[model samples]
Target: MNQLDQLKKYSTVVADTGNVELIKKFSTQDATTNPSLILNAIKLPKYKNLLLKSIEYAKKKNINLKETVSLASNKISVDIGTKILNFIPGRVSTEVDSRLSFNKNLCIFHAKEIIRMYEENGIKRNRILIKLASTWESIQAAKELEKENINCNLTLLFSFAQAKACAQSGVFLISPFVGRIYDWHINKYNLDSINIENDPGVKSVKKIFNFYKKYSYKTIIMAASFRNINQILELSGCDYLTISPTLLSELKSNFNKIDKKLNFTIKNKTYKNKITEEEFRFEHNEDIMATEKLSEGIRQFGYDQKKIEDIIIKNI
Candidate 1:
């Protein structure tokens, strides 16, 4: 079996792209998409129709440009997610607008709207994971949403505190970024490169995995933002790993023996204390890498969100 097939034995492989066509080529169990990915996918010739459809939906709403842009953005995300769901048997993660990451009510409202759109298309809520940023507000929002049976994937996660908070909030999943963590450390220490075994990103995921297993937290850890095939190989036994099409292709071409790097048989001591909001903020603030990367990630996604809105305006 190829490395991709071999890795699936231990962890669920997810396609981290908005391009449904590329996702169809891979044997991914789930698909994840952010504003940036949605923007890129809509730019492709094949996905142009999705954009046109979004524009048409916006025009029917007859709202102002601001409201229209917001409506179209959610429409496109759900439209693409709906398309992806046809190819994969598992759920599709459609991200909330990063611009609303700090607003709990807005986040919840948008998430529900996205869910409603999916349901209107005959997709069940159980087959969808609403993606939100790992901000405190977003985490709280997810907690309430979960109560209503709306599963969420807390994303842009980079700190142990963020992971702990998400787990305690009873979120369905958390995507701890690997490549962004590695990139921050590389530039911080001015290192030429780090070995795969010693990669900071990989180590972060391992730590979270072990912690979750030790305390028996039901929240799933889906490692994201991998920079290389080796990083994916390093996280062979995570709950899930969302990989780009480029890395997915690389894994499909390579046939190598892989082993489970993480398991539930953790030997670490368990902790029963819940993470307070203040403690979570302080701990995450202390980690310079997480602090900077989280902000940077939000900004980048926000920029892409604007780009998508711009395209909608042009079509209007």
Candidate 2:
């Protein structure tokens, strides 16, 4: 069997793209999209209809140009998410705006608005996972949303403290970014040669995985932001892997035997006591790599969102 097929035996593969057509080609069980991916997708000629459709809705409501652009910017995500649902059997993750990541109330409000937009188009809430950055506010928002029966996918996660907070908050899923973590260490140490076996990113996910299993936490660990297939292969038995189409293609073409590198079995294990909010903040602040990467990821997403809005504003 091909590596893709073999990997599927151990994990649920999720397409990490805004392009539904590419997702269809891979037969990914689920799909995830963020402001960055949606921004990139809108520039493509094929996804041009989503923009035009949003504009049409704004016009029909007699909204002004500024309002039209804002509405279109928000609606475009739902339009694409609705389209993606037609191809995949499982859930589609739609992210809340990164600008709202630090504001718990705003995050909750926008998350509800995104879900409302999806529901307006006949898609059910269960088919969607609201993506949020793993900030204290966002995790708190996720806790409230979960109480209302809304599942969330916590993204931009790096540190074990972030993972611990999410699990304690009863988050539905947490995406520990493997490639971004690896990138931070790779550049920091300026290493000439590296061992994939002892990859820092892989070890981070394994640590979280062991903690989850040892304590029997229900939050699913989906490794994201992979730089190479080796990172993905090493994390073969993770709960879910949201892989890019580029790497998916690489795995599809390579017919190699993939092994399950992670196992979740209970042993004589002990985990740290659940952390307080102050402790969570202090630990996250201390991890320079996590602090820098988390901030950078949010800024990049916010930048792409502005770019997408600029494009819509131009048409308006």
Candidate 3:
């Protein structure tokens, strides 16, 4: 069996792309897309049809030209996600606006809007995971949406505090960015070299996985944003791994035996610790890397979103 097949024995492989062809090639069970990925995809010549189709759909609905940016962005996501859904048997995550990361009400409002768009096109809510940044507000918004049977995938999660909050709030899944965490440590420490076994990003996910397992938190852990195959292999037994096409292709080419790296069992740990809003903020602040990465991830996504909106406005 190829490494990709072996990895699938232990984890559900998700394609981390906006390109339907790539997702189909990998036969990924699920797929995830963000503003950056969508923006990048529409810029490609092959995906230009998707971009034009989204704008046309919005225009036909009598959407305001001035607000085409927002509508175009949302339609593009749904259009891509709808396409992806036809190929993949499982869910496709469509993220809410990163600019609304801190606003609970707006996040909820947009999340529903995104889901409604999917449902309007005949995709059930069960097959969609609303992607949200791992902000406290976003988590709270996810909790409320969960009550209405809307599952969420919390992205840009960098710290244990964020994971704990998500688990406590009863989210469906949390995506801890393995590559981004490693990038921060390598740049900050100025390390000429580092051990993959002891990679900071790898360890962060391990910690969260162990805690979640030990305490029996039902929120799924999907380690994501991998820089290499080693990081993906390291978390082989995670609940899921959303991987890019580059690494997925690498795995598909290598017919090697992949070993499971994570195992879960109940251990000595208290599952219940009510984290107040102040404590949550303080704990997140104490982790320098998480603090910096979370903010940076939001800013970059917001910038990409704005760029896509600009493209829509220009087209109008």
In model 2, which runs have C-alpha deviations exceeding 4 angstroms? Answer: 59-68, 266-272
Q: What digit string (tens of lDDT, one per residue) describes model 3 on residues 151-264?
A: 999999999889989999999999999999999998999976568888999999999998898987889999999999999998999999999999999999998788998987
Candidate 1 deviates by what RMSD? 1.4
Q: How close is candidate 1 to the true structure, as a TM-score?
A: 0.97
Candidate 1 per-residue lDDT, tens place, 1-316, comes to 9999999999999999988789999969999999999999888888778888988887798888898889988999999999999999999999999989999999999999999999999999999999999999999999999998999999999999999999889999999999999998899999989999789999999999988988878899999999999999888899999999999999999997888877677555657788998999999999989999989999999999999999888887
**For model 2, what is the alpha-carbon lDDT of residue 1?**
79
lDDT for position 62 in model 2 = 82
**Structural similarity to truth (TM-score) of each candidate:** 0.97, 0.95, 0.96
Q: Candidates ranked by TM-score, best first?
A: 1, 3, 2
Candidate 3 overall lDDT versus native = 0.92
Candidate with more favorable, higher TM-score: 1 or 3: 1
